[model samples]
Target chain A: MELFPEKYSQAIEKALERYYERYTAPENLYSPARYILSLGGKRIRPSLVLMAAESFGVPLEKATDAAIAIEVFHNFSLVHDDIMDRAPLRRGHETVHMKWNGNTAILSGDVMMIQAYELFESYPKDIFRDVVHTFNRVARLVCEGQQMDMDFEKEEYVPMEQYIRMIEMKTAVLLGGALAIGAIIGGASTTDVKKMYDFGRCIGLAYQLTDDYLDTFGCEKTFGKRIGGDILEAKKTFLYITAFDNTTDKGALRDAFSITDEEEKITAVRTLYRKAEADKAIEKSIAYYTDKALSCADSMPFPAHVRDTYRRLAVSLVERKV
Target chain B: MELFPEKYSQAIEKALERYYERYTAPENLYSPARYILSLGGKRIRPSLVLMAAESFGVPLEKATDAAIAIEVFHNFSLVHDDIMDRAPLRRGHETVHMKWNGNTAILSGDVMMIQAYELFESYPKDIFRDVVHTFNRVARLVCEGQQMDMDFEKEEYVPMEQYIRMIEMKTAVLLGGALAIGAIIGGASTTDVKKMYDFGRCIGLAYQLTDDYLDTFGCEKTFGKRIGGDILEAKKTFLYITAFDNTTDKGALRDAFSITDEEEKITAVRTLYRKAEADKAIEKSIAYYTDKALSCADSMPFPAHVRDTYRRLAVSLVERKV
Candidate 1:
């Protein structure tokens, strides 16, 4: 089954297309914001917004603003994060800071943050406060996650639970927040809204873990980004932490990371990860979360067809046998 | 007379003091946010919030959250701006990025932005949307202003009008927006709220012009910050732009600015500024705007004593013999 019954997907895409035409002055402040949206991703979060809203009979018009707002908010985080990481590229093009100066990126990103709330003005006034409160909580969590991600760099080890918490905050909470907001706006009951939120969040966790798996093991052409790129950066990702924590030869693993040759370093780290069964462990964890994610939908009080749509989304994200 | 007979000031200070006790983990984010607030400035913006609200008959208890929220958002912008400007200090102490790294500053600043809205949770439900919508607009304007400030750096000569426009966006709008919000929350009529906002904005413009005047002319001891500092940095302030625009001897002005000796440069620039009568002209402009600002209050439909409190604020800010 598809994410929704039908045409709402196209309606959302059209809404997003209309959103980019908003023009603000001092082109440097607004052009990057427009440009990033043009370099589109799958639009999964927004589509999920529409899906949740539609499932509860909320009109596509009611959800379009939120769909655009969440997408814009996502781009805001990317623009700022690119500057902090000093990354030269994003989505196979020059990052905001790389194309402009850091100051431009910072200022532009700041505007984008405010503009997201501006878009939220389209939300129905009755539940507007709830959506804003949820957004505030999620936005704060995302910032905290980023701090923890940076903090992990200085450490030899981050406990698996803390690592999981970091990823949930950094990557999953926005996804969950998007779904919950959509369901609430669609007039779903409290019980249904909570289930949708938990379902979205669990799937989001699985999504990140799968991304971790693909970075190390997926086909180079299929991945559409560089394979083994994180390893080259000495990034303390889930794979690195899990493998390091499981290994008996911790000192050797530390010294291996310092290897000067990029190819040799990737090779050595891959071997260590395999020996520690880190890849298997991560794959198993992804499966577990994916199952939990799908099960969250199974008991929802919604119609069987609406529940089926959720199961299909979870299966597509997990890419496992249903 | 003194922005609420002085007791509201104490109430606001106490509310702000209690605000810092919010505990968030990892200390890196919350601690710096607390530290910046502790390095207190005049608390003018928050005081204006409470002052405007009280002028409309709202009590201190009814307005403290907004007072605290505006102050926190102000510091959030400062923390991020210091990073963008790569400045080492603020309020006579090390900047957040200087004390921590750039990443910490960025993350902490991001959290503060979200937390500002979180503080608005205390607003009465009847007025919450009004407060949030106003905040969203002002926050975006502040970003636009910062962008304009940076953009002005690239140009050899900025028009006097454009310079004023930038400072109005960068500095004045937030003050105005704060007042407008406070008035709205305190049950002021729509017409009176607009007048309050315009009154606050005109005074904000005057406030910035006075700041520009003080940089070149005020006593360093009384200014409580370095004087001659803008001249040293080649920061084209209102004085510089006015002097350059009006001077028949433009080339000499340019050469004077290229002076390598810091002491001699300030001396030369001050002489040129005097020749152009930029100081006297700017003072005239300040006086004119001050009159316009205070007049905005005189026409308010409220009682006379409430009007006088505003008059006193205007005089204190303009600091001219009435």
Candidate 2:
């Protein structure tokens, strides 16, 4: 039932531990980076990087640096994003900006980014160029996505396509870029690299849509938190946008949004979402993206087992409650 | 009076203008970058990039992207640094964070850093890798230097050597890196590139020392701000550190630093600086570094005029009132 090779996950954890051991100086600037990294996530992106590289005939050892680089860059984005979001907690601990001050968080995050680029220097000339080129493009897109997310906060309505685009840029592209970097480092052909990127991107979209779905529809215990947290915040998530688009009782939807009591607001919005079939809409979109990911994986010039692994990864990422 | 070719500046301006025109989307993200760029600087770093490339026999046009990259990186640092420093003005305009908000400044600065790396993609694979390598090293050092500076603010005493190292990393290495990158792109020999980096580093040290000196001694009108601004802020500049190291009357120096009134603090600190002969100490350091820069320039593989132009640049940058 493991989604990826368990050994890949173990290797990644060891590599990250070795990598973070060097960040000891200037505690104010580097400690936050180390701290944030230590607060573990699923390590899915780095796992994808290793799996892609291995699938392309490169050993996990050869691609370890790129895997670490992707993970580091991802954490760098989180450190800064947490500051911008005014987020107090990450992974049940104080965020970087909360642990240190915002200024420390910003400076530390800046160094983390440079460190990510430095990780790519171990590669030879052509691979280094391609890897960094992909990094720069994806990094810029991530920033744009963050800006768009922030912009959406003040707006009354955000169209479904635009919201998807924002999430795609903000979240999906990095996943794609991570796979592409690993593939390039593994010496995959251009077509295979592109397909790997497409595969990761489709998986990322499906994963994010599932995240939205779980925020409302998931079991509180299984999801590890209360459901409808997004509704309480009146977030214009996929279900919110879809419901607004399809609901015949627009006034009731608006009134539901204006409800004063948090529990009542969550209940009313969930009811409206079900009535408009936004939950079904989100489920279909998730399936659509998941299918696209499988097709991309199937088209890759990998063995049948490798394709099956990717299929399982896509399924596990989207089908989970948490 | 022109230390560099007039056409180089003109070309740099045009190149920057053309480069910035493409940053139109997500007004909050790109506008701050554009706005920061629009507020003119001396263009010293970019000009160094072009001048170094040209000195190595590359055409000015060949180095425009690198030149712009260095400048953009500089501004990106400023945008983030201003946010950290809580400064309201940059080049007499509202700082990015002040004009918009801290979140915008942080995000915009993040994108700008990525954009700097993106500019390197146009080079051939080897050259691109080399240039980006130099950039990544310098960028990390710059962050470390900034952290050191912030660390110094809390300490009662900072060693003069550490202060110099901090400034060297924070301010000088970028200049050196910029020159080195240009030299690399222009096909300079490894020795020549090292010499170019040394020359720029020496000049940067001298220039920064002169900056510390002018903060207490220069005419307000010419310096474009009130003299002793560093003293007023109790900044541990070269003068402050050296004065504390050399001053016999430690109590009086401490008393001078603790003076509550603004003008009194300035006057007391300046008197202590002169008494310690820190003014003389700083001037000597500036002369020493400037001479070292000239020696470096003289040893480079260049024509007499090229060497002479570098000497003039060193003298002009370090010996200026502003």
Candidate 3:
């Protein structure tokens, strides 16, 4: 109760190490899985699983397997997505597909997925189907979301609503699913389970919006990444989508984006973004989703302090300068 | 009983049609899954599921979901495997990867794997874990097997035993798993389940051998293929591995395989194969595995006539001329 998700994060890390430590023979397949998991990131989704479980009074032991499953599944998606995106680094390390060849990455990623399912077998018998069905639904949507994103990439423009659905599926469902699975394992009532999912869905959307925001506005000191790189690539992120919606002059956006000079392009796009009110609109949207996420906690059956942690988590995630 | 696998196959085909007919939006993703399924595979694995369930008096209604799951999962692997091998066709139709594109195939194949799990959720609550667990172990091994196959392709030569194990993992495990799942659903005893798996393992080995044998020797009218394609590619099949093992001069085998002329290469390799007793060894090996497979049925808890059908199935599978 005192440390909330931070306390749960340590437990999840321990469980993940234990789950993957038993890696056996077939060095080719198991090594890539272990290697990818070893490249650490913020264990946010699994922490959500554990925090939700704890809030409902479920023991950490009961939630451990689901936490590990979410982490491993997330890594699995990263392995494949990195290949599709053709990115070279993840977590400041070589991505699985890049370290290994595409074939090895493909096969290892496939095995990691089954390994994710195998984790569910450790759950209590009564709730096994609930946990598995939730995972299946979420996993399927995640794939669909990825397909949508890839599909949209080739198109000149994507509708704002379609873009929202894309991120929700590709990025958000796993977050919501992790929460729902944790709550289910904690034996929460159906009402609370749905509420947690809605809460998670909003938080996930806000987190993605903030990520899109940070790509443009984040300091190199925090992210060590060049701002407006997405603009340079003509990525149709929230800002770009919102900018198109707000502005009548589409030619300016094209002109602003066509600048080859990095600093100039970023400055020009930012000016255009401000004129379209896209900057303010994106800020408002992040708040909107964050508030929607926090409001779900008000009706939650859990105590006020317990719900406050969720609000803190959402706010901290979406409003971060980083 | 008289209809045997053919009877079960009709039911499997019906279930598959119904399952896939629900295809909706996101044509990019679902179409490839449905397209591959529509390519009209023999439905052997699903039929095996239904037959195994029937042998233990498990009704078809109880088995259809698992049957469909196995078919979808098998197709999923085929889609991915084709991409890995860069094969252009499946069952004389454009492979999913070739028909659409690699990214679509990867994503669709991923969704198909999840769909396989989703189908398992439709199983009766009591047997869900058993069915799902069997599918996971088999699916994981299949990936491992595929990895081994790709790895072996890189090496100059592979040992006979390793080749056998690779196919057993890559090819046999799914058949074994499908049968095992059907038995579990039928409430068969643990001994009977193991027996079915063993029977399937042996049959899968023999079937693969028959495929290898036909690839080099069968009539094109029957095979609808170019004979000696494996020889041209120098694939590490059982025959090629055995040829390498039985020959004294590695140089001669290499020379025989290096011939660019199709007839010359096939004849040179066939002659070398005969001199090294590889042809005899392969025939003996196929019989050995087939007999080994049939022996598992000798002490089956089911009736003698029921056991006779399994023997007939194995014999027809291995002994087929076309």
Candidate 4:
């Protein structure tokens, strides 16, 4: 069975379509914004908002303004993030900063942020206040996460635990905030809001872990990017750090890190990961969190069918090749 | 007498103090933010919000939230603007981007934007929608203006009209939005909201023109920076464009424009401007708008004392030498 309610899925598609319309004017202003927003990825964050609202028996339309708010904010972060990463492409298309200049990207990103808050104005008064407050907290944490990520680049050693916290702050808190705010808007109980937050946070963690695992082991075609892009960049992924900490064959790992040759370094690191079973270890960890996230979703007091749908969705997230 | 009610001024000061405190925690996260915000140039934008709110009979405490919102947003723009301008310092202090890295400035500026919206959560529900709508509109315009300014740098012929529009969009719109929103929150009529917007917009235009005049004519010590800095940069200020439009001394003006030596360019531009009487012409235009702005304020159905204070303020804005 599908993991999300059909109504929730349908609502998200409609909201995204309407949300896309707001950027039609000032073509130069909105073009980059639309490009980044319509980059053909699954709108998972908005989906979580819709699902949480639907689980509380509220109609999806009522929750949509908040959902769009979250989505716009997410895309805003991506535009700026792409600029910082100097990544030329996102989702198989040139990034906003790359397609246009960095100034355009920065300005467009600013408009996207303003647009996000504008979307929030459609919510009921009390709910709007709560949403804005929640959003502010999440937005700050996102910046903090980015700051930590940047700081890590300069540091010689970053603990695995610190890296996880950084990801949680940078990536997961917004997801959790989206769900919690959705539940609040749907008039869910305080306990239900808290529970949905936990559920979303766990899923976000699991999803990121799955991404780290796939970076090393997934098929290049299925991943839609290079198989070892993260390793090549020497990104502090779980596989590399785990292998560094626990590998019996330390020589190859150290040699791989020290290698100045690009292709040789990736090969050397992958060889060390395979020898150390780091990829398998990460796969096990991904499964552990996936199960944990599913359990969190199941613990919520919702109809069995609805609960099962969420479980199925969680499983699909972990299982997807990309 | 001061234009603002005493209570309004005190309230703005207190609220800004609190707003500064919000940046106190996560010392690392806020140091750069506070450093820029506390640099202590005139807090004119926020002060305008407060004064406008009081003019409409709103309690200063209630207006403080919106006032701080505009200030935070303005500072955010300044932080990013400094980076784009390649400006090393602002208000006699090292800029955030210069003190930290560009990434830190970008990230901190992002947080400041969030904080701007967060401050708005303090307003009552009755005006919440209006506040959000106005804030979003102004935020978008600010970005649009920045883009236009960037576009101007590349374009060879930015017409005088286009330059004015750029300033209107980039600078005037925020002032209009600030006062207009303050009026709305202060429970003013729709007509008054519009009138206040016009009042602020006219003042903003006159303000920029006066700024241009002062940069060339004012005493070096009192100008707060080097005299003729804009002329040195070959900025398309009103004097330069007007001189280009009217003067038969194209050779001298072109020489002024073409000179690579900074000191030589400043002398040449000033000599040509004097020869064409362009400085006097620009001063007349400044006076024209200052009068126009005063007329707008005079026509408002405010108390006599308030109107008089506005008239004096308008005259002082244009007439004062840095």
Best by lDDT: 2
| Candidate 3 Cα outliers beyond 4 Å, as residue runs | A1-6, B1-5
Q: Clashing residue pairs, candidate 1?
A: none
By the lDDT metric, which is better: model 1 or model 3? 3
- Candidate lDDT values, in order: 0.84, 0.89, 0.86, 0.81
Candidate 4: tens digits of C-alpha lDDT, residues B140-240 = 88888887787777765568998888888888889888888888888888888888888888888888888888888778887788988988777787888
The C-alpha TM-scores of every prediction are 0.96, 0.98, 0.96, 0.90
Local accuracy of candidate 1 as per-residue lDDT tens digits, B160-254:
88888888888888889888888978988878878988888889999899998888888888788777888888888889988988899899889
Candidate 3 reaches a DockQ of: 0.79
The 10-residue segment of model 1 chain B with minimum total lDDT is B1-10
Pairs that collide, model 2 = none
**Against the true structure, what is model 1's DockQ?**
0.75
Q: Candidate 2's residue-wise lDDT over A1-322, tens digit each? A: 6667788888888888888786777878888888998898888888888988888888898888889888998999999999988888998899999988999999999999999999889999988988888888888999999999999999889999999999999999988988898899889888888998999899999988998999999998888777988887777899999999997788999999899988889998899999999999999999999999999988988789878888888889997877
lDDT of 2 by residue, B1-322 (tens): 6667789889899988888786778888898888898898789899999989998889898899899999999999999999989999988889999999999999999999998998888799988988988899899999999999999999989999999999999999998998999899899888888999999899989988888899898889989877988987789999988888896788998898888998888998888888889989899999999999999999989889889999999999976777
Docking class of 1: medium
Interface RMSD for each candidate model?
1.2, 0.7, 0.8, 1.7
Q: Model 2: what TM-score?
A: 0.98
Residue pairs whose backbone atoms clash in candidate 4: A3-A309
Cα shift from native, residue A322, model 4 (Å): 0.8
Supply the TM-score for candidate 4: 0.90
Give chain A TM for each model in order. Answer: 0.94, 0.98, 0.96, 0.93
